[model samples]
Target: MSNALELLKTRASPKAADLVPPGPNEAQLNEILTIAARVPDHGKMVPWRFIVHPHETRAPLVEKLIANFRAGKPNANDAEAEKQRLRFTNSPLIVTVVSKTSPNPKVPDIEQLLSAGAASMNLLNAAHALGFGANWLTGWAAFDKSSKELFGLADNEQIVGFIHIGTAKGEVFQRPRPDLSQIVSKR
Candidate 1:
């Protein structure tokens, strides 16, 4: 497998908040996404979609998130409250990966969902390999019904991840990984 495991071992996901400006340019971003779209899709449904929330209009989305958080947590202090909003606006580029399921006989919805999730991971890896920092996060906002509605997702659709990509503001130390034996199985 050309020692793919080595590349996997070296991958480091930066903290979402630590991602700074100067994100992927158009050509680079497109290349990374094209690579990501190569993830396995059962039944070839291509059950995932990407919405690149460009730098310009991200403020409104951040405002909406702040309102959602403030309303949801009435007692949250200003700093704590601001954190939720900052998560959105801080990233130079945010790729919203939506999992749009297909009602098909040959492919189970679960498989489609997995494919979408795989696509998100592929995007994260692609960004890192392209010399950028990326973080795949799904906070409370991801599961919020209102937020999903705002994204225009249909009933069968869901948010797999919000990939935050940008230059790393500082060094990100890689944490330890779980032992493969603990999670892997052999039959």
Candidate 2:
């Protein structure tokens, strides 16, 4: 098989906690974002943006997230709050895909949203191609209003995903995939 096809077939998301350091450096990150931006942008409307959350910001962000989680879930125990605390800090770097849909007469909102989704996938693929493990994820924090405000997301913007990027700490098991025959249909 071709190299591109081989890479596509082998690509899989590693668990966030299982991801280690040595993430994309400055140059690598720039290239990765460049690759990520090359998506199907209809009407030349780039309805997406990326938020790079590096190591230094992780602690403060996690603290804020934990507070938000506790406030939202008053019944949550210490363990649950701790889980929230470790969410973003588990990985060395996090690239948040933010969808900023605008009023467009030519292109619909759905198409712009798809572009954002494509960007997210592209980021994951780019990280993997650069020899890093990445996982696209969104949890309760993604939907929380306080968290969104903390992230500085505008009213029209939404969190598409939080992509964790780093080296895999352990073995990455390949889960079973659906057979083409089971899902494919003849036109």
Q: Which prediction has the highest lDDT against the true structure?
A: 2
**8-69 per-residue lDDT for model 1 (tens digits):** 77778898888988899999899989988999987789999998997777888788778877
Write candidate 2's Cα lDDT for 55-173 as tens digits: 76688878888999999999999998888777778898999999999989999999999999999999999998999999999999889999999999999899999999999988777
lDDT of 1 at 18: 89
Using all chains and alpha carbons, the TM-scores for the candidates as numbered come to 0.92, 0.97
Backbone clash pairs for candidate 2 read none
> How many clashing pairs in candidate 1?
0
Which residue pairs of candidate 1 clash? none
lDDT (C-alpha, whole model) for all candidates: 0.88, 0.92
lDDT of 1 at 158: 93
